[model samples]
Target: MEFRGLGFVPLFIALWCTAWVVVSYTLTVIYGHAPLLMYISQTGNYYPENITFKIGFLGMSNATLVLMLLQYNFILLHAEAFGARQPMIQRILLAMGITSCIGTAVMSVFETDFYPVTHRVGAFCAFACGCVYNLWQAILLYEVPGIRRAICHIRMVSSAMAFIGVITFIGCRVSVYTKLCTEDYEKIIEIISISTEWLMLLLILIQLVTCFQPMQHLSLTVSRKGYTICKRENQDSAV
Candidate 1:
């Protein structure tokens, strides 16, 4: 069955992603200027208490990431529980679960400055899984013999997201290793940091879009296959 209004799901996610961008820009305007100074002095020069801006910014960004992670988690769960008819989906679920776990651990390390390693590892795991899933879906779309056009569209979106994910993951690693905006490379670092944050927003947008695809697919499938709809609805609603 053809899915109608599926485009709206990704658009909605893009709208939600705007909030993170706003928060990030606000933080940049407020406290992102002299990160090196703050790092050295271990305090903000002006309105020291406003350091909350950075914390709040990070919190909002992390919250966005967590929301995306939860969405993947739900998809993985569904694949495991109800996708026995599609065994390839089971492998996707495993990849999603592994990446989600890594993402969760990296996200949980907000208490320390040493989260760089955790973040890099988590991003790598998630990026790898995204690439694998996208490639698998792309191949499946070609070989399945039906719904090739629709799956091809999904493949395009998934591959784009995978590319963005890998780039963002590598960017994070570069930011960590290079220590941008330090006394030595002050200007370069600032640009890199801001660019990293912007890239992060894109990654979040892609993840959210990817998450909503499954819901739209399920909705369309149920609408097309009425007999399976009842059983599918019962099973999906339980999730």
Candidate 2:
């Protein structure tokens, strides 16, 4: 059976992410101009609190990340329980969310100024997990029945964007790190990678938009204990 729509909660999670992007972008603008090749995290650092954006941005972002992760955790776990035949897929989704949350927190706290190497490690973890997370989500989006009719195309497009972004970032990293590209070329590649990152994020927001309406068709209820209890109803009633 396919799950058609995502519950209202996921939309809230997407909103948090949007907030993160806006705040971070605004902060970067307020500070002295940062080169495009520089990572977004770099924008959060080395400036006075009032003058810089990333400080407040990361703090708020971390909170949102935690909330988003927790929401996905519950969502996927419930999916696993009901979607028995594909337990592994559901489990992996949950794992990705948790790992991404950890990565976000680590990257948020360990700024380039205070912990350059650690910061990079956190960034790598977050990006890699986030990419894979989207990839898996794409699979589920296509395979799941209820929402697939409307979202299959969306999933394909969003996942494709995510993969393109991941691949470009990897290629740019290899070129920059190996000194295979000139400084100017490397900078340009880095900028392209950043653009792809934002593109992937935008796709996620789009995916959430599609998921919101269909959740109503799924007979998922929140019990008194605040747990998601998926009890599929008769087709007529669900509709």
Best by lDDT: 2
Residue 214, candidate 1: Cα error in Å is: 5.8
lDDT of every predicted structure (CA atoms): 0.46, 0.60
Q: Say which candidate scores most in TM-score.
A: 2
Candidate 1 local Cα displacement, residue 117, angstroms: 2.0
Residue-level lDDT for 188 in candidate 1: 60
Taking the tens digit of each residue's C-alpha lDDT, what string does model 1 give over 144-231? Answer: 2223365456556656655664666466546657774356675565455456445544654554554453434333333433622111
The global Cα lDDT (0 to 1) of model 1 is 0.46
**TM-score for candidate 1:** 0.47
Worst 10 residues of 1 by lDDT: 36-45
Alpha-carbon TM-score of each model against the true structure: 0.47, 0.73
Our tally of clashes for model 2 stands at: 6
Model 1: runs farther than 4 Å from truth? 1-13, 33-89, 101-105, 141-151, 154-161, 164-214, 220-239
